[model samples]
Target: MRSPAAGVPDPTSAALWGLPLWLWVVLGGIGLFGVFQVYYWVGHRLGSRLYASRLGRRLGQDNIRRVENAVRRWGALAVYGCFWVPGLRHTLPWTAGVLRISYPWYVVASALGCLTWVPVTSFGLYSMIWGWLRLAARSPALAAGVAVVVVAAVAVLVLRRRRRRRREAERRPEDTLTTA
Candidate 1:
């Protein structure tokens, strides 16, 4: 069912077993880029740990300063990498100034990283799928296995962080709970 790496077989060329090739290509690109960006942007802008109001004020000034230093020293790669790194992605940019990673550089690196990841993911999918289909005459269980692994990994990360936060909260005295 999957198309080639470009996302779909070229509409102008390949006519296969289903919808017109042109429509699939156009829709596929829009779905991939548009939907992905919106999801990423929403997460970046308002995820609980990272929203400006939360981390910006809660951590006071010192931790923010360390973050600012990290940004300045490493630039956009640091910010872009944060997306996959969970804690940073949600909270870093809000206090990025405290970390001192320049906004301009952060934007450039984040955009490039986001842009490249999509095409690369799509292309890799195409290669894997094409190989699977050609070699097996029908794709096997590999893709399903990959999906399960990715989901399980993400779940483990989310649960681990939540557990750590809960344990830390429990250790704090009733009044000291205000600090983290």
Candidate 2:
């Protein structure tokens, strides 16, 4: 909102902390891309042993299998799509490396994903936080209510997902036994 001597609006006036919002978004995107590269290399180095590692066990075999299937089916395109999927974003990169998908294609897809996804999420999150702050300034009680509602919604979603996973786990053994 502030302007310099030349009457041009200062970009840093809208910044979070000392850096501009655009700078933060760019850094975040670059950082995420770098992490993806590391995941790919580690998976490539581990090869099949990745599935037996501590991190892999933590991720669970079922999750790995699902990621593997995505990579197998979609190849490089899966890398871009994964950016939009919370769970698959981290897992699919590793699987792609293990499967040895073309590095050049993988780089292109991941870069494109970073370019598109980062700006949208960054601006959206920025708007949400600033809007909440402005609302809080106007009415403390209303802001508190909004916060509580958002938390409750997230909690409900998490609980439902956990219950569904538990039920599926319980049924898996029965399904295997019946087939056998």
Candidate 3:
């Protein structure tokens, strides 16, 4: 699942069945672009209803206003950057649509954002997963031992933190003033 380049795994670059890396990248990128476009359209189409609905209320008007301001100030650049942020990824595209940003700008910015994101995620996943597999293959016991040590270290840190918190709580001074 790695690219021709050594030590770099690119799932999109990896051929499936009889496919090739370039094809995979192209198809995957297209698919990602389509998805973002759909997201933008949905926002455009249902902008008012979605924003006024219970779900929208839950998202908070203040937060929505902030995002709107960001889009107004930065325009397509905000949408482009939002492709990488989790909640914003969902919100920004729709916001762009709600605000009626130029369609051309939306397409270009969103496409460019997807171009950057899809490959990175695809390649990074492949590298990490395959790399771990290779390491485990080479040293199963060592891998297991390292995992155990990491878990033990985390547990020790948690327990120490709890103990410290308890000691601090016990040392807190009591309030001397009483309410009338």
Candidate 4:
């Protein structure tokens, strides 16, 4: 195999900011694991008072309750599964800590989650971005159209979700009053 030219990067190898892609993935996994530990400890320390904290208020009681239920039901498994989910990824770990799930199990599950999730997301996201960049280089107009379509789809989804939530909220008070 031929060596890359002086000062030139290898086209076949993925590198970012002078670091190999694998290194970045490893670092990212470690960072996420550390953050998850922090979240767990914070939740553990906060205990029952977590529900009254400013962050808790912002997260909303209903949402925290949902997370709490998931943690209670699934235990450490939920911590692993949360890595695949969007909002739950951030919330579930804290709930696990607050509920005082088995620490050894939590570590095992979280480590597995980091190991699987970071590489998949890192490589997948890198490929998507590079693919977009290549498309942009070849056809700027096509790239712009693709970007617009993605943005529009996300906006539409967000608006629909918001509308649905508003309708739910409107009905909640009436339902509560009737039940009372």
Candidate 5:
């Protein structure tokens, strides 16, 4: 992908930033999802490495004990809230597991933290993505093509869902009105 060299006379970047607000929005979402997926994968790997299990070591056990207390006492909201906090997320899950923190609660709290992370940080990210996508808009036809493809795909999905629902309703027409 040998693109225009640095400081080259490229109009792409300018064009992208000049695109309509809506196109930037769509691209921004796509960019945000990509970034989050990368972050999630890295975070998981970092957690496992830093908080690796050792069949039975005192330090490991102590770390687990501390994690368990935090989770057992505060739950996932606490886990997730501290998710982005260095050292906490990595050790918390491992310790919680060892401490026998309820599996469901662990999942719930972690999910909450992930959910919280997005709204808290996505706005800033979306702006950055918008700027990047704006650069892509230098090629008008390419940008329009992308927009059309996305719209067409969404339309196809919606039509498919509606058709499936209609068929299911026809097959079970009697069930639809049986209120007794």
Candidate 6:
């Protein structure tokens, strides 16, 4: 793949002020953290109405209720765990707000979750981008082939994992013992 910038070979080198690209990545992640905090605040303010909206109904009242129960049971830890899950990320914070988790606890949990999530995401992105740039520089065709293979492998693995989980779920009832 060709670099977007004609003259500039390495887009990563493009930076604001004197700071390196990775610093900016970290800052962006922190910014996302702040945005999510505000998102949580909105959920806090909206409370039940937010959950009663069309989108919320789509998310399923039972599901939201389950999340609410999880929040009540686990407190900040539920927020932390759900922060890493893709679909649940947005909902978890809002649920935390509806549960009226302490402001300080929410902040601490958010900070801790972001600390783990942001750095890993930034590093993974940096690595993948650089790896692709290097591969494409050597041979664009090879890079494209490699990208396809990686995506296919990931898809297969996810499908297999889901199938295995479904099988386990199916067997659970039969696996239980019955009293005479």
lDDT of each: 0.55, 0.84, 0.77, 0.86, 0.55, 0.79
Summarize candidate 6's per-residue lDDT along 13-82 as a digit string, tens digits: 6455798766887797688789779868988899989887776765666668888898899998887887
In model 1, which regions exceed 4 Å deviation? Answer: 1-52, 55-66, 97-100, 121-157, 173-180
For residue 136, give model 2's deviation from the true position in Å: 1.5
lDDT winner between candidates 1 and 4: 4
Cα-based lDDT at residue 164, candidate 2: 83
Higher-scoring candidate on TM-score, 4 or 6: 4
- The segments of candidate 5 whose C-alpha lies over 4 angstroms from its true place after superposition are 1-65, 125-180
Between the candidate structures 2 and 4, which one is better when assessed by TM-score?
2
Model 2 Cα shift for residue 83 (angstroms): 0.7
Worst 10 residues of 5 by lDDT: 50-59
lDDT of 5 by residue, 1-180 (tens): 224565333323323457854455456545544443443444344543434434223234444556556767786555665567755745555555444545566666665665555444554565555544765667767767777887899999999978976776677655343436
Best by lDDT: 4
- Model 4 lDDT-worst window of ten: 171-180
Which digits, one per residue and each the tens of the lDDT, describe model 4 over residues 1-180?
224464333434877899888898999999999999999999899997987777776566777899999999999999999999998998899889899999999999999999999999998898788779878988999999999999999999999988977776676653222323
* Residue 71 displacement in candidate 6 (angstroms): 1.4
Candidate 1 local Cα displacement, residue 172, angstroms: 3.7
Estimated TM-score per prediction? 0.45, 0.84, 0.67, 0.83, 0.35, 0.69
lDDT of 3 at 158: 90
Which regions of candidate 3 deviate over 4 angstroms? 1-13, 141-180
In terms of TM-score, how similar is model 5 to the real structure?
0.35
> Alpha-carbon error at 164 in model 1, in Å?
1.7
Superpose all Cα atoms of candidate 3 onto the true structure and report the RMSD in Å to 1 decimal.
9.2
Model 2 per-residue lDDT tens digits across residues 1-180: 745574433545668788888999999999999998988888788897987776776566777888889898898899999999998888889888898998999999999999999999988887688779878988999999999999999999999989987777676653222223
Model 3: per-residue Cα lDDT over 19-59, one tens digit each: 87567767888987888788778878987677776656655
